[model samples]
Target: MTGGREGRVAVTMPQLGETVAEGTVLRWLKQVGEAVADQEPLLEISTDKVDAEVPSPAAGVLAEIVVGEDETVDVGTVLAHVAPGAPSPGQRAEATGAPPVEPAAEERSPSPPSGERSSPPAGGPRHRHSPRVRRLAHDSGVDLASLTGTGPAGRVTPDDVERAARHAAPEPVPSPEAPVSVPTRAAPQRVSTAAATEPLPSLARSSAPAANRAFRTLVAEVDVPAAQWVGSSDQASVPVPGSAAAAVVAAVAGALRSHPSLLAPGAGADAGDLAVSWSTGSGTTSCLLSQAGELNVGGVAQRLLAGATAGEPPPGAGFTVSLLQDTDVLFEVAEPPPGQVATIVFGTPTRRVVVVDADGSPGIAIRQRSSVALSHDPGTVSREAALAFLRDVVRRAHSRA
Candidate 1:
């Protein structure tokens, strides 16, 4: 862009990340007419994973500001211009009590103007925006350009972004079966597994948005019986010790293979890759589980524990799982950061195993147990898909017992 005055150096947006195509102008540290030194901070830009200050390219007066704070623009777009010994547009406007004017230009081929701060071509309306609205849109994955503002002067608002995000989210599919189970008068109350146990449909499609669509997420959780998994006490005290966690991971991975929508490529065995987090006496540790083939629970647990002891970051995987022992707490779904699809949490084992006698009377056993949960995006993973996978885990664990 031309400087707000005669001949100046053009300052364009710089490339920030390998995957970033656009960035939001978080703020302008330097205003028009301000003097700047080369390499000094001039503005801030934000992307999904980064927030950084952009420095001035050359030492000079800030003659013009092309992109305003809070605007989102493609990389390489002109942000401003700097000219040596020139009065900035803001200063000139103030001194003369006149509106800020565009820089003088030589006769050039006419074209549409779509730069950061430029108005739309004739016949198209102008959109007004504020910093708060821009930040809100950035955080919520909403596009201001796609929204119709209700604020005065046609400015976008926080409420507008939130409403747009909500409207963009996919509608949840109702479960065919009632999730809540009524407690029997004679038996103790059972925790609800409704979130995870929806009946599976023969074929289901993910509600996850396409790359071009607004990013919207949905959360769900399902509880499973701990006894079905840890019926054999000896299984828990074996060579690997925390085989329970490994077994759960294996079961989840195996189940995910059948639910392609939850997997990365939307299908395949590799899509079943998972990251598991298990608690140790010291703290928690995470490890990657590639295939469900062998499921060496003890070996996996040992590696994870070793990494935690050495203070290493968790291994990467498609999805994440966490196991918390000896608590009455049930699993709950939590919001994940950008790019993560789902999280499975296993809570404290059941206090005691319930058994049936020859008389058909339920009695307490010496074995302890707990429940597991799967929190997933309803758009990418349907309730039916998650429920089916959870059920499969219980079935596989029981068969091993």
Candidate 2:
């Protein structure tokens, strides 16, 4: 290990938000003595609202594991340390202040708690395991301290937990009236008796049905000549205020203003109207419940992008629009989250824009071609209203352009 604080870099728990003072270490991508790159995903942290992959601050060898898996620690707490390069097992032990103790000769066989690989010493460091393994152990009522790990460096794995569980379980006692060996043809009778004696599956414990969604889809193509822009032609060199997403958002918002009934009154209303908001970047399909009845498309678009970038939920919008820049794929289907009126997914140009020549010849033209999908609550917004809303958006887009 490198000397002093010169080579060692402390890996601290980050402050995700003003309210989030602590977070749980969900998983570590690199183990002790492993090399890691700067900005690479080092570990996963789970907060109340988001699960994020925390990136490494600098490229180095993971030298120490301070905070164990599933351990919750306050923000700025040092989770681990990184050195300049990888260290040998002996060197690692020396660096971490751990005594270098080898397994006894009798512990050669690879079995849980067998031979010299029994439980750790009373005051010695406990065997290191992953968050997943610890969680499994907890749920299965297996004692981590009692089981010998089979993973590298004797770290407890999920497999070790499972094996411990099997060993810890009590065997079922045989009934006084045991049945004699049954012929192959009579196996069904034995199975029937076993089934009859077995307890039925707990209905209440079973997973519930998927939540209901009022889904609606609208597919339309609007012609947008390359010249369609909001800025003055004199300032042609300057970038336009409207991106493909922003323009669509503004158009939708303006159209919704015409039909105010489509806008929801508040969040969490089962059958209320919905407001429209647009999203930036690619991610899981989601709706931001918005209460802004009359909204500025440009401002709302900026806010949506900023909020998503910060890993915060967008303001309440009855319908959320996600603009996907990835154009390689031609089509996709997305559903709205429950409690929202709808989620609109707008795709980049897919189909070609063309113009008919006066001589009846067809030629390709430069235009923006988008595929729009609206997943709406059928109970609150009818299919006809959804289609009309989409048409109005196209009209607005054309008029603005």
TM-score against native, each model: 0.39, 0.36
Q: How far off is residue 182 in model 1, in Å?
A: 20
Minimal lDDT window, size 10, model 2 = 187-196
**lDDT tens per residue, model 2, 140-233:** 4567888777888788887787566444543233232332221222211100111012211111111223453324455555544343222222
lDDT of each: 0.51, 0.52
Error of 2 at 130 (Å): 68
Question: Model 2 clash pairs?
Answer: 216-376, 263-273, 264-273, 264-274, 275-318, 288-317, 289-316, 289-317, 290-316, 290-317
Model 1 residue runs over 4 Å out of place are: 1-241, 265-268, 279-283, 292-294, 298-316, 326-328, 353-366
